[model samples]
Target: MLDYSVRTATTHTPEFLGLPQGAWVQEGGPQFAGQGVVVGLIDTGIDPTHPSFADDLSTDSYPVPAHYSGICEVTNDFPSGSCNRKLVGARHFAASAITRGVFNASQDLASPSDSDGHGTHTASIAAGNHGIPVVVAGHQFGNASGMAPRAHIAVYKALYKSFGGFAADVVAAIDQAAEDNVDIISLSITPNRRPPGLATFFNPIDMALLSAVKAGIFVVQAAGNTGPSPKSMSSYSPWIFTVGASAHDRVYNNYVVLGNNLTIQGVGLAPGTDGDSMYSLIAAPHALKNNTVSPTEMSLGECQDSSRLDADLIKGKILVCSYSIRFVLGLSSVKQALDTANNVSAAGVIFYLDPFVLGFQLNPTPMRMPGLIIPSSDDSKVFLTYYNDSLVRDETSGRIVRFDAVAKILGGLNPNYGNSAPKVMFYSARGPDPEDNSLSNADILKPNLIAPGSSIWGAWSSLGLDSAEFAGESFAMLSGTSMAAPHVAGLAALIKQKFPSFSPAAIASALSTTTTLSDRQGKPIMAQRTYSNPDSTQSPATAFDMGNGFVNATAALDPGIIFDCAQ
Candidate 1:
């Protein structure tokens, strides 16, 4: 649910963690901004024509590496002109999606041009044209730059619009990336599940990535978003740079001020205060199911099933949806909720995070009425308090007290509610390596480390933006480990530039060994989705919270030296 609004431009990257300005760059150490390295993006394809991929500033250090065997696969939908110097290669894999009857050729683009903005945004994050102009809804956002502005980008279209493509498709994509002989692969693809009782190698994608790593390409994958929960990680391959997420000092906060004046702060790609709105709020106390389904199951008002709701009570009211237990009954996506709302003719819906599951997941579905996901921290307290207050209410009185909420999107032009950066994002999937490596005999700690992923601003495709909500801009902001992986991907490209002979293992070692443990507060770093004692608001993070810690590109640049294992 990559529900992010376009953000005013913000400059971040290896420099955000101290690249050229840091001591490493000061020492005249090689500050390689990925000069000759090529990054293979195996996600949805890329939009070559976006300002981010312009060849105006691309360096002519290498004319497509000698090992690159990949061709610019051309079709009617994707012409040969699409591949420029910046986007060195482009290809797509629809085998699995085609076989599954999920690939709707009519609706989804057949070429490498990303109809889904994710690929373009990610590609830009890795190696987009530096200093592209940005404007969102006519608002002037300053120029933006990629982490590795001078690096080359080759794209493999494995993931597709609406998340089409199966594991087999992903495997094929990896195989193609490997064949292309890319220097580094930044795979933002996340798996739906960890194969039960199977070694990581048993999974086709893992095997494929391992092969890519063996070929000397540094592989960076998104640590799953199911975070703070120890062992809920999915990208568990030991050989890959499984990257997790951390918040940058610049936070994208959405503030929801309830009718009771209880203002709660959550996260998303904020649209600034100008986008704020006020709405009537309604909440369902119990999520218990009726005779048809299990008990204690319900949605506050997420429109999971309009039938499950008291249509009379919910109509004309802002529905408050809560996740009790994945306690879903028929409602699958936010679209379904929109349909239900249209059916009921409701004003809007406010999604409150259940303290238990409490993700405040960034991906979102557009609403017929206004929709905002209330953060778990504040909403949980509100829910508990509201439930208690409702106990004394007399339903027979035929009068119900309602709560109104003010939704304020804060960032860019708005008063900045900044964050203490390098903190483990509440949603970054934690790890202790959820898999049993006994079979593969390669037990390794996971998420490798964290990077600035929360509400990251990057280039987006106008073709893709039409289908999405919130942003009518050329650039969009996204969050999650998906955004984090490319930060490392860009860094890996820089590392490759500095040491072209180093193996993937050596690059991973340098990154892991040089991580920082303390955060902006000078306190021990903490990961998301964790709670301890005292106030229980936040608990001490463990190795699983942040495998190594926040990534430091400056330190990683000159790790002194790295030793690769070989007989």
Candidate 2:
């Protein structure tokens, strides 16, 4: 009865894993890129219209898997022909939420159409069509492709946007997905709380998934997002393959240059201020409308209140806003600030880190207008000092001010590569596995593997129920262990397609053993500790931080040796 919320692209999936399309083969056999496999996903619903889920990618006619008997639930929103060859099955289970009187039909679509973008994102990351243009805010970051683009996706919408979901509904979805004879099942969700000792394995969801394993389905789950702490794993059952989140080499960098010629690099997916011309810069508080009453920091510093802003003062200028604690608490957002800037006819925006808000990692949030965020408190201090010194206020009343601060935003559309990556993300749950509620530890390793989960770009639902910033965006960038699990699931499909007779345990063994321990820089993989503002503190990761290490999909194709555990 607890609600669980929702949690991309540039791992160059096929290329980075060394499983280049049509080139990676099993010994002397045909290409085994998940052609005949079916991946079943249990989460929020999916967006049928997304090009990632479209069936017309290949010239050769794609057909539904003969062994898969799953059906698409047709409704007004999810009309006929929603299921194509690529998306073979789609269904939603909300009876439990309805009985609990928590299901809202409008927000949580009654059909398999995803209102929350989580399911669509996860599904596309696993088995969406290959090489779909990933455009957001009129910028093309890159083309996105699933790990197993040739595989079919079967979606079971058990979780909703309003209320995460109930165990009964989740279990029901699992039973049906298993009955449908899916080759793999990917779960991007974690329980809000762990069950007591020994009951963890006996829980309805685990037990049903265990049954699926017996029936030859590979199960993969996220190793929860609460991490950098020991024994924080949510998926503990040894039968399930748990995945942790890791960083990839790809990164998008946006920068701002002050009139004083100080260029500060930051994160933002937005356009640049009119072609290298530094615009008139003014702070949000200084741009408040004449006679505006008693404005708080939320309204004046963070630019959350558009009504308080003076259009005349803000027009054609780059407004400075504070990235405050309210932003972390969900009371304020970068999107709202952007909207306010647009409403006031501001040319662009620049956000400085509020020293009060500490230890939070800022992802590259998308913006329609030209903008950038200064993530480092040190850089923010530098920028603020310059701005304050440049201000010319009236000596008598301190009311007649002349705005002199100026800066220009550079285009943040391009991506940069060659970052030392595959390092365990700070939020990817760590483990020596948890034993019980008393906080005892188990001997078995929890996260069977790690995969690229930070700053992943994938298809997004138009409804965007969980994220207001990406409401109408076709693609979004997100980071979480939830984003890591489907990667292993899709890779599992590739292994299954290659070795048709391999048991689930054997496949897991292949994935677990065939991993690389070094990063692109030829150094040992590191783990983020999340103790400081920039959160860049790192140390060589332990087995618990990155179990067995980062997955190498091509090496997994021919592991040379595989352990066959009797189920």
Candidate 3:
């Protein structure tokens, strides 16, 4: 379910999150506006005819066809076509099945379109158009502007539609990018699962990444959005730049309600008929029940419905939950619950936990509502309580009482802060180099830097656009290190534009030096703030979390100091 019509814009129009839309271009755009530096975006393919990029050059249809000179054979077997709305190119690769072992693995790449919208968004953020007016929420904002607005793109459809593919294809793509002499290689895809005992085998993709680095191509990868845990690191190879997510200055008010028995202390008293309250009890994501295989859609009505604690089900509700649902579902669930309460209803929803899901928060939207989203970890206890209750309930009771709950604001959660602004998101993965540590499998000296990754909006596929019923009027706002990695990649292109002789190591060093060790909120990240002792508050530094500091694009472009790999 990808939405293609939601075009990413370039102005800080406050419609979304008031992010620095044209910040990269404020000073007459990047130094490499059109120097013909080829940047290879290795992810899902791109939609060249996107209004923001329709006129820009694409490697897909360049009359002067480029070479894909790599150790792995390259071919243009993927077809290219343009619809009245978009220009799409397709490609495929094979995947290795873990359960069946390597010998049984087969080629799995299929015609690639962004069946999932992650790749398209990543590409746009790295090299989108410089000036095109984008309309969102009835306001006309500028176009799909990237850090390197004028760089030419060589898109590799390495990640398949279902996000199923082998790591070998990724390695092949990297080799091709290097042979093609791409200025920067942006990788937004990571392994979906860390196979048992697989790290013992030499990963061809890791080797390819190393090769690309040696060839002087700057590699930028997503740090992953799994959060404060030690097992959330996405990519830990020292050869590439890893990125994190941060909250924007803008606030999109949404709400969630607490369960009847579970009382959140800080929030104000129950609602009154006088009017809406303003304080927020907790600055967190509210939990929701989800079926592992089912997709959940949230609406305002749902949020209102969840607030009715008096409903019969509240007494025995079992909350089945998952974090995979879209942010919209969380917001709507909260709003619906509140409305139900206003009407003096008593139904409660129970949330049950499904394994391996991530939770999210709501950003400020133009239409204001009081809501909050809870992290999956925080809601697990509540869910387990009701789940256990259901298992032991007497046969006389009817279907397990299920009441959905969403949190709403009462006050206290302000959006303003000093340099510690909400720019750096807490959920961004951390790392300590798993390869060097037995608990994790990541390389110790990798993911040297961080970049801008949060609620990044971008282009959508024609197929995706048609499937989305709501949020259909404009661009999609997605958050992840995937979005942030490209910003750094584009910056690398700009550096190459200025200092053509600089090697990839120099570029990585420059970026790392220029970045702030702390996040936008001024919180010390990386090795600086890990729990290292056994004081109940301290733990070991695990490579699976906190790779490096956040990236400083402005500083990387003109670093005061640089690391010389030659030494």
Candidate 4:
């Protein structure tokens, strides 16, 4: 057994920004605990012992256990030569090694044990045992669990341990899942680049998705994390439920600072009093500290021992440091400062921004340290003016002030950045048209729905962040549409739990029609640009980017209009 710890159960419930929490609970909870549904998850396999789905397995074949009904469609070889790094242990490799009659071949195709933790994390979220004693990545495990704890799950090993797999294998897995009579199919994988002559191979996958849809099996796919762009993977497929990412909070505690040289007359400046404040002070130029090199031409060793950073150089004076400088040193510098706060105390660390990089701050782990980031353009002018004029005094203030960084539950729709406010993540792929190449004007007619993906906290492997190089881990925070698809799959289980009579198309319809158009900011969620043509008349509101806003489980369960596809 790999030494893995469980994540702490979050007190906050996941919510769709701009969507009502009450509606979610009322519609999804009461209607869909997915009583008799069996969902087939095709990707990396699941850890059968995970707590969330402890009760979901069954040894008997037909008339499966009430909670679940399926078997592991074990197809690939174990411990093949290619899988040396992914599948550890001689025991896991025994079967494959014996069958191949050679250790080298065994290493090439390792057994279905998850070398990359992605499959396990997705599985746990979709339908793991409800409770367990595992702690990982600061998360503890217990009953506060997946969307469909009672739903049964079937695992398929399609993607290889090397993170690549034959497309044919995937098509086979789909056929197997369908033959197994799975009520839903969840796929989080995508092609690296469209395979050469992709349409030929893709036609089958496309047909598989449509075939699943026709079989009354709801198919949920990740919208891919290739961001700032609208085109991402099979997300364009019309028959499949495509999901995008959104921030969990409506308001983020982000700050906009002005420097001493900038005009500060209108803004307040009483140290910490004004949310945004600027001051005029001469400080060290650029020097590295804590293994970090300055953005300008300077080495880490030279900067650490340089006299420019001494108290004499910065004492009682405001210092400006560029954010770009820290990357050279890594986040370890931040951690070190927090660890040694009492030993080597400083006034504060102010970050100067550079135009080349957009500043998107991650939630700091060591909660109690003060740091601030200023835009590069703003910081440059301040630096120049303060350097030239010794008597320059700058002031600044703003409504956007730093708030304690803590994850919180955000409900309903609002677009302002505030504490724990949800927004569409910077990396979530957008859509203007569905895969069918239809030109529907509204997102409600296209891209379709949203789900939980992007920086999602979940199960991790024991290897830790540094060791687990691939996308999934024994435990860690992962971002991408891959994370989101499972959430929808789990919800599909819930939908089946409530309306056993509903067809997959009806379920997809309920999910689509119930989606909200406004984002956390209350602005209409729209698709990003799909083509370079400047005259493109399509806006974000049309079927281009925001397919029907995001998925709303609550509304879907109680949808007023159910889609009735023509037979």
Candidate 5:
């Protein structure tokens, strides 16, 4: 999922970026399309009813694959018939947590239905149906399609809220995936910590992956998103195809125009502002009527209750809020500011990115009003300049400066960085080794491949209806390495469809060796820099950044010599 900041309508399909059907269709070559193959995903599970998972375009009935032994888990909320041919199998595992009295049945379902949206998104990316109209915040992002539209999906639920998944649960899911005899397994589960050794035989999850691989199932895992910091990759298992995330040629452009005639481009999921309108700008610190100093990032950034704002001064103006660099504000932060602005009937809100989190990382977020996230440590300067200039002057003053700020939608028609595809995502994990040098960085390179993972559009869970973009919708957008790993998995399924006799290692080799270092036009690809005093500098994406660079499915179909390795 490329962070969906709600901008632009891509003129191309998923295949245009060399996946789903782009490269192969353009080449007019093998029509694999992942037909008759299974893509097993171990995550939080999936929405059985998402159009992305339905073969008949509805949650009606479809025949299950003959080899699929996985069960369609039935709960009071989710029925058994939900697992159709597209979603051939579904299962849940939370035994350790339930036995340990740690699982909350009230919030966490004991069934296979996805309570969280992560699994559904990744699964859809791997092998969901194609030509599904993807609309986020009322803006259609063309038609959404997956890497392998015809691939069958087998879900293994293991993750829970807060602390991700218990190790036992994740490991058990992998074992079941093997038992179910799925062709490929996608593991984007966040590691509890960096593994102590190179070989994956020690950790329970890694051990499960090793067994799955030995059983001839291709495994794909995420290079954790704790990057810009080198040697911070969590998944280091050689057998598992660890994937890193990279930026594609899609950018969501949400911009802001100041009263001082300064038009600063930003990003967000602002769907309301139809056109530009003039308004006054009010700073959050200035709106503080009580003047109580905020100590926490949320309190300051969100303009929480304790910070009493002057409603009189705020009415009919755009609120500019600022916070420290320590934490990135969540959806709650966006809602809180909207609440404050709504009280005064303010036009909109602009969140000044206080250092730490880079600007381009601001994805489109659903908002009550036209809200834009400005990625700048000094955006406050713009507000202050406007405010001061707008102040009424005395008799001695020659000319008066006016602060008439304006906000525009800059919606999903033209993204700012539309052509800057394949840049390593800001948060995509980077690595030459899995851990720091003190713990001994392994000689083995991780993140075997990169794919369309950031701000990706996919199916969402209705039960998890907390987002404004997904109030009653079937599909939404998100970003993470979790979104990246399944892409390779889908490709693996296609390779299997073409070369059924090829081993998992052989499939992995085809995908890995057949990757491209340059973009479609042969431009050198740029990688995101994780470690620096100035953290935004993008370097050349190497094998550490992108395993073999972006996955090239068309070329991979005929890599004459299989590049087998010793793992």
Candidate 6:
């Protein structure tokens, strides 16, 4: 029962990688946007309907490469025409899960259709059709284009949202992908643990990838998410080009302004309340209409259940709630809290980070109404202190007499830049190369390179069963070395397209050797150590933190030297 878990793309990538988009020439060669290359994604299935996979992005008709012979699994969810010129192939492998009786068709799609959004997102990052508009929470972030916008996608969906895929299924998917003659295979998955001794490289998945490399197919894998720690690299095989996650220049920020004129920066993609005026704030427990209700009746501070709150008392006031472990477990969500707020006609909502939920990085959640999520527990403490000081409680029975706490959410959709970027992400797996189950180091330099993986915007499945907040959105912003792998995969496609004769090792060599080590401001690349003090605590990145530094797409086109690895 060897199970492999998921890893989890997109925009501002092409220019950042220095790859030219659409009709852009590549040093006396045809457009290097992966025109004739195919990228095989081995992860959760894909969404056939995402605009990023549409084949109509070009004036000329898209034609499937003659070398590709993959089939699209036609089911009720995934129809016959799901495979187009751009999305050339689609397939699913779940015999292991089915035999093990863990295959729940109700939640995990039997077809190639993506049940979890991970596959679609990674595919879109690798080689989704160009110029798809990204709109989430009614705000347009920007148009997203892949690194190799014209590269063909061949999907091998083996992973699922309900349960992760098994090694047998993953190996089968890899074998079939290599059999289909895909130019590149992108794997955003890793084993639950390292195998013992030589088994590390002898594992079925890595062995199949070895065969793929022997067949001239490039393989890119994520360097796991267990990072900022030594020997955390998951893909330790020397044949595969492993990628680590890093930050990019673009970032979105939101803040809350208290009635006392103190502003606290936070994370959320939400709007502000009416005008600049502050509204009365009340904690969920204090606003309960039924004072006799037991604490066990509902989550007192999470605001998950609408009936647990007093609609009349909540209306025209800013409701305060807690962000807890329930959010991580999917037992509670910002979307559910927003629903509770809207049902009660609350003016806005503020979520204070629970002290219990530590080391968890909060992404910018979309809010339908005015909302703010205070990610720092310290900041949450400050907020709670202000709220308590403004509270006027009844002296006799300890009831809230007056709800005097006040605050306002500010518009948070605007994009900001000028921060140093391409720093090795804190969660991006680091290396001294991982040890086998026997605790022996592989002696290989892992995370062959680093790429933009934080807060990446990419296509999402409408059936986003993975994230409750993004269930119906067309795009999602995700972070992981999973996203980083596809960035290199797409770039590999471009390099493959430019030099059709280049071996996988040669392509990997070009990318690794031509990387840039400076940020946008010409500063040396840095590595994030921890989330606690992400901004001020970073130090200069070492080779283990960022391998050959951030990938430079343009320079890779002509690395002048290519190291050959005998397959």
Steric collisions counted per model: 9, 3, 97, 77, 25, 3
**Candidate order by decreasing lDDT:** 6, 2, 5, 1, 4, 3
RMSD of each: 7.9, 3.0, 10.4, 10.5, 6.1, 2.6
Of 2 and 5, the candidate ahead on TM-score is: 2
Cα-based TM-score, every candidate: 0.73, 0.93, 0.61, 0.61, 0.84, 0.94
What pairs collide in candidate 6? 9-456, 10-456, 10-457
Ten-residue segment with the worst summed lDDT in candidate 2? 1-10
Q: What's the CA error at residue 30 for candidate 6, in Å? A: 12
Q: Which digits, one per residue and each the tens of the lDDT, describe model 6 over residues 1-567?
A: 354433341668776665553223573322337877899999998999999988774556457888999888899999988888888999999998999899999999898999789998999998877678889988887788877888899999889888888888988999999999999999999987775444567777888889999999999999988888777888878899999999988877888999888899888888888888989998887777676433553366789888877898889999898899899888888988888899999998999999998868888888878888998888999999999999997899877779887888887887688658879989889876655332254467877889989988899998878777888999898889989999999888888888899999899999999989999889999998886666567999988888888998888888997898777
Q: For candidate 5, write residues 444-473 as lDDT tens digits.
A: 776677876777777788765324445456
Q: Please give, for residues 1-567, the per-residue lDDT of candidate 4 as tens digits.
A: 111111100102244422125433543442234445776777754444334444422433223444333343233533233211111111121232233343333322344454546666676666543443434322342223455645566666565443245445567677777766778888887655444544422455657778778877888877665554544434556677877655454221333233422332111011231223333333334222332323354222112223334444333334434445444335324333322321333333344444444434333121123433343345445544544444322346322122111111111111232332233455566564323343344233334666656445455433222222222323444556677777778777777767887887888877778877665567665443432221132244444345566666677778897877842
Count backbone overlaps in model 3: 97
Error of 6 at 263 (Å): 1.6
lDDT on C-alpha atoms for all candidate structures: 0.66, 0.83, 0.47, 0.47, 0.69, 0.84
Please give, for residues 1-567, the per-residue lDDT of candidate 3 as tens digits.
Answer: 110110111232122221233324333444334245566777766554456445434443322124332222223323334311112222333333232243211232244444445565666777666555645434443455666666666766565443344666666667767777777888876666454454622355556788878877777777665555554566766666776554444332222334344533221112211133222121011222331121234332133334322333222221222323532433333323434433432222222222233333433232112222333444556644533443322357432233233332332233223343333445566665444554445446444654555545566554343213213333455666677678777777777766778888888778767655654455654232222211223222222333345555555556777776851
lDDT per residue as tens, model 1, 1-567? 111111101355544677647633533432235767889998777777788877754445436566667788888767877776667899887776777676877656777777777888888888776667766544554667777777788998877765455777777778988888898998887767665556654677788888888877889999877776777677787788888888777543455555455666644332333334554444543222242222254543445666665566555555656644352222344455556655665565555565665433543222334445555645567754754464333368633434334333333233244445567777678776765533244367788888888767778776674234433457776777888898889887777777788889888878888888887778777554543221244555666777888898878878876757641
Q: In candidate 2, list every pair of residues with a backbone clash.
A: 8-456, 8-457, 9-457
Q: Report the candidate with higher lDDT, 3 versus 6.
A: 6
Candidate ordering by TM-score (highest first): 6, 2, 5, 1, 4, 3
